[model samples]
Target: MSMVRYKAIIAYDGTLFHGFQRQPQGRTVQEELERTLSKMASQPIVVHGSGRTDAHVHALGQVIHFDYPKERPLEKMRFAMDTQTPEDIAVKQVEIVDELFHARYLVQEKVYEFHVQIGKPRSPFRRHYASYYPYPLDLAKIERALPDLLGTHDFSAFCASGSSVEDKVRTIYEATMVHDEALSELVFTFRGDGFLYKMIRILVGTLLKIGNGRLEETSLPKIIASKDRNCAGPTAHPEGLYLKEVKY
Candidate 1:
């Protein structure tokens, strides 16, 4: 028949996989999906992901697109692929899209959430998903620092040390910190047009430093002005970060 393009919403617990992108060794979400699709079609198949999540990072609503010459029903294709994938990775839904549709370049915005547990004992079951800080945090200080990060700015200060991107500017649409005392969890939520490498983790680290009285709340602007990664706080662990959603 004719060629067809398919789009799918994928979710996975990235703890076991190397990362979203395919690698020569170690399991990866994209590699596994492509391998299954290749077997079913009896031909080579490649899956393109909207974003590249680092190792040990999870995605709740990741998008992927691929093309094939054979026309198979979307539901049946999903079922066949799901059967081959491990329990940690799941295909949530699939649809046929126009040939020009892409999973990555067409995205409008992305939302990421970093989960942190503040004070007291840690939950054994959730140790893999959340970052635990035993000391008390000053929510007021963190809230005060949020506004400085709201508008567009050069985010070089918040990026990881080894990032190679030349342009460090990014527009943060919204930045908020919420605390659920009952759950004993602190959630840092950010919606942005795009992000620098490890930007969110560094931002969260700086906020935690401010909350712990190690840094001044007013120091945020100066940190951003410095445009140096070393001036920022430590990069938070990857396990606590989640790709919450991608808005097209």
Candidate 2:
């Protein structure tokens, strides 16, 4: 049988795995899926993800594509892969697609969420799920600073050092924050065409700094103009980051 291209949406806890990519030294989301799928296919199966998430970054609707040696029903493949993979990783949806559907390149928009816990005592249950900040936050300051992030900008200041992507320009379609009173957490959502390595995390960190008065509210635009990573605040904790969705 000819190879069949399958597209899948998956979610993983990401706390224990190294990252989404397959690495020689560590267990990764791709390695796990490839291992299980290859066993079922009776041949090697390489999975291509929409994008790579750093270690400890969780996902709710991460998309991936791979080729199977033989054809199979989409539901059956989804069920088999879902059950066979480890407990933390879930194969949520599966469908056969055209061979041209490249998960990474064809992506049009990606949505990410960053959670921040702002309380006196840290909750044990949220240790690995949210970044904790005990400092007093000025919501107005953060709200005022957010408009600076909208639209297209050269975000080299927010990109992590290890990224090799030459083009640093990207558009931010949406950037908003919500305070979840029930959980006492600040949830930040960002929708963009593409993001640089650790861009969201760095943006969240800098925003938090602005909220806490560490950084001037008007300084974000200057920092972006500077295009200097050193001008940005520290990268936020990986645990609070989540790959929320990918749009075609």
Task: Give the whole-model CA lDDT for all candidates, comma-separated.
Answer: 0.87, 0.95
- Per-residue lDDT of model 1, residues 26-123, tens digit only: 88999888888888778898999997888888988889999876778889978876778888988888889999999999988999999998766788
> What TM-score does prediction 1 earn?
0.95
Clashing pairs in 1: none
TM-score for candidate 2: 0.98
Stretches of model 2 off by over 4 angstroms after superposition:
none
Per-residue lDDT over 136-155 for candidate 2, one digit per residue giving the tens place of the 0 to 100 score: 99999999999899999999
What local lDDT does model 1 show for residue 32?
Answer: 89
Task: Show how many residue pairs clash in every candidate, following the order shown.
Answer: 0, 0
Report the Cα lDDT for candidate 1.
0.87
* TM-score (all chains, Cα) for each model: 0.95, 0.98
